[model samples]
Target: MSRPLIYKGRGSLGNAAGRFEKHTRRAEDDGWGSLDAELPPLQTEIIVDSSQSVISYNDSPDIPFDRSINPYRGCEHGCIYCFARPSHAYLGYSAGLDFESKILIKPEAARLLREEISKRAYRCAPLALGTNTDPYQPLERRQRIMRGILEILAQTRHPVSIITKSALIERDLDILAPMAEQGLAAVYLSVTTLDRTLARKLEPRAAAPQRRLETLDRLRAAGVPTGVMVAPLIPVLTDPELEAIVSAAHAAGAQSAAYILLRLPLEVADLFEEWLRQHYPLKAEHVMRRVRDNRGGKAYDAAFHQRQSGSGVYADLLAQRFRLVCRGLGLTGDLPALRTDLFRKPHAGGQMSFDFFD
Candidate 1:
């Protein structure tokens, strides 16, 4: 068995015990005798997926879109606060370092998308991308699955919305730019903090804040409708820089903006706490204190609207600050609605056609 240690460019507290296992193991570092010293550095492990379908739909009122797609199951960004971390436990992996090192890719995602969109009963709506995991993560450079999906969307004139923290999205401007002109595409760059040091630990593999800003600028310059998302706003942590992030993104050519409070559901709570102890030990208690303040004295409140915007005075104050800043910056609660009338269904022979009367 391979030993486990923290890699230089990864974000994790090393492998914690897998939650589903019958027995659990603990690591002790009393100095007199420590087992952690002999462990080898953890490495990324790629897992190929066999997805039967590509599009995932939900009827949740909390979500703005009815359909979304996650090209990969596990994200390489390694965000310590990622709510998606617990999802790995379903695959029998630990919610700690295992979530960051193990990556899963759906090789036939594009082909599956093409088939689904070909159905005669298909409905055209803005497909949300990167809702679960980043479609433009580092593995994308080799997989090219996202690029293939974009090509199909562009060819079919399907509307789509993308949210990511990667600069790699700029590579698909060739397809996105044309779709944007027809009101069929929009992009949102999620910026958590302006502090490069914090970002390095927060999401070790994600693009830097400056690089994301550059990506937004390039996308807008290419005529792609772009926006900014100050997401998972951590109280007393990244919260202090919320306004600054929006301002910087605005200067980078973002016309729309939004924010979401941090979410630590399921096993993510332990994963994140472990991360805090490893990197921000001194401030961990204070940080989590404020996190619980807005979450009704809990680490998280999963109640619909309250989930995105916490409850209580702290939550209210955060909301008010966001409203004031958005008003001052001329941003509103609207993003351009992608066009559905332009959708063209491909015939059985692979020829696309749209009926004007219908």
Candidate 2:
């Protein structure tokens, strides 16, 4: 008997037809299995990449950071609304299961980061981690690639910022605390919804909402600067809890908070649609209709300014609600910028020296 195919919304897992091929037309016309399927089994694949580059720079006008490093590709968090899912298609992989199951690790990330930072022309800035994909995903527990990157940054006194939804980050408090004390580091924990059942289905592999809150409290008590991020505020599904999420974070010791409207870009649009129809068929149409209204009748709008916050009456209302609630809860504040003057490149002998002494 043939093994049952794993239906991952877009197509069957591991099937050549699911892989992106050049010069292939009418691909969508191919018949696939039904959309309804039980939980897909987790499959892991190891890939060794030999590349000289690791840090990525972005020039988006609205973004705060210019440089970031993603130690891993295709996050295992398996968030249905992930905007980075389309990246897997570039590797001839499906944006559905392949985006979550197939893992890529950058073992040499620390070496390259050190080489880059040691350059005479290197400038000290707040290097953001887990921007494109999570650096502390499940694989990090075993691979320890994110830990390696943190070690290098700590040695050089390089300023860094981290954003994650995993309690696993608490394990690095030993390194983060000192940096934070020196005003060299800060962290933002993303918490989407407080409802456990909804969180499980929306972000299948992320830490439970309560666990993330506990992590935030621990970070604050450790003298590490921390903030809360209520991201991807889904309409009708998780939107109702926006104010409550911010209030809870504030009470948990988060000094500040921010939020972003849900973005359905590229393959994420299809994946989210499939998830909505399957899980909340009653509200699927209403959700998509609101989403389209926010995007000006399109599935997504990539405009820089309007991308983070949607455009339209509903989007405006959500924005207003978030602003009002954040102000009321005293959670609307920006973290102090980390000091860069303290940065000193370590010498080859594992010591740091300053030229001012001479």
Candidate 3:
């Protein structure tokens, strides 16, 4: 077998072909000695997504929100275990390295969102951000697409729920704090693991676990309802930090908590397995065994209710432990329901109500 390819700060072990690709390619060492030479660093490529619509509705019974807006198609955070990675294949890109390096940004997201929600038939409901990919990913710093979307939402008095692992959200306190004061906004920071070293490998470009906690505290201090998500809880790897993460978030002023067990769907399964073998070779089989125990003897099961948190003995235990710890930490309740009553229908020309100014 050939040696694994490890990019300095990237999470994928290798750039595997997407599921739809008919051609398969691999690197083979010829006697030329070029295979051992250092590879050029990967650069992020940005593509503009000219999609006319911004809101995507889903009927998945597992999730709470019905509609969501993803300003970007591929995430730059390079999380090896991202469930959204497989989605890159639909765009004719690899679900491995290409998913992080090639990003599709929607520069007109705000205008499209304004047009959609301003319609006479449109109904107001809390819109979700970061459901598919992190809205505050590193690219957002320069793109500011998320900020523009939030500005429109705030002006229309629309309710929104945001999830992210980036400390960059702190910079939007001026916008979020006021919306939250009116019960129109809530934010959840996904804390995967408390160990800084492990986190760097698992989610290479995301904010450190400690930095996320500090950002949560800052958001709470600014009167923005803040919560914590112990997301993608890997069985034998990061599950041990569950209780500790909840406790730490509670200490940091988290008012609500949630979690999702590790999900390895389609191309994500192979990518994650490669990551596991590269990072924790000895424990890879043990970890996958525990995952299969939860996933009904397979690498993954996509049944509605069983997909997020698996269905089995191990799954039940994780759920029970999360509930018990949350109860103990006074984080059992959900964030206040966002208000739709304050929504103001915009004019046909996409002009927002000026009631927000006064």
* Number of clashing pairs per prediction, in order: 0, 0, 0
After superposing candidate 3, which stretches have Cα over 4 Å from the reference?
Answer: none
- Candidate 1 lDDT, 1-358, residue by residue in tens: 3233567777776666667777666565566556555556567789998889999999988899999989998888988888888888788887777787898899999888888888988999999999989999999998999999998898888999999999999889988998899898999999999999999989999999999999999998999888998998998888999889988998999999989999999788776777787778898899899889988899989998889989889889989998888888888766788999988866656555554112
User: All candidates' TM-scores?
Assistant: 0.93, 0.89, 0.98
Q: lDDT of each prediction vs. the true structure?
A: 0.86, 0.82, 0.93
> lDDT tens string, model 2, 1-358?
1222344322223222233665432223223533334646556676876778888888999899999999988878888888888888877776677777787889999888887877788888899997778888888999989998888888778899999999999999998998898898999999999999888878878899999999999999999899998988888888999989998888888998888888998778877887787778999999999899999998899999899899999999999998899888876679989888977776645444554122
Q: Report model 1's TM-score to 2 decimal places.
A: 0.93
The sequence of per-residue lDDT tens digits that candidate 3 reaches over residues 1-358 is: 3556677778887777888999877777887776788877788999999899999999888889999999999998999999999999999889989999999999999999989988889999999999999999999999999999999998988999999999999989999999999999999999999999999999999999999999999999999999999998999899999999999999999999999999999999999998898889999999999999999999999999999999899999999999999989888799999999998867779765568644
Q: Candidate 2 lDDT (Cα, whole model)?
A: 0.82
Candidate order by decreasing TM-score = 3, 1, 2
TM-score of model 2 vs. true structure: 0.89
Best by TM-score: 3
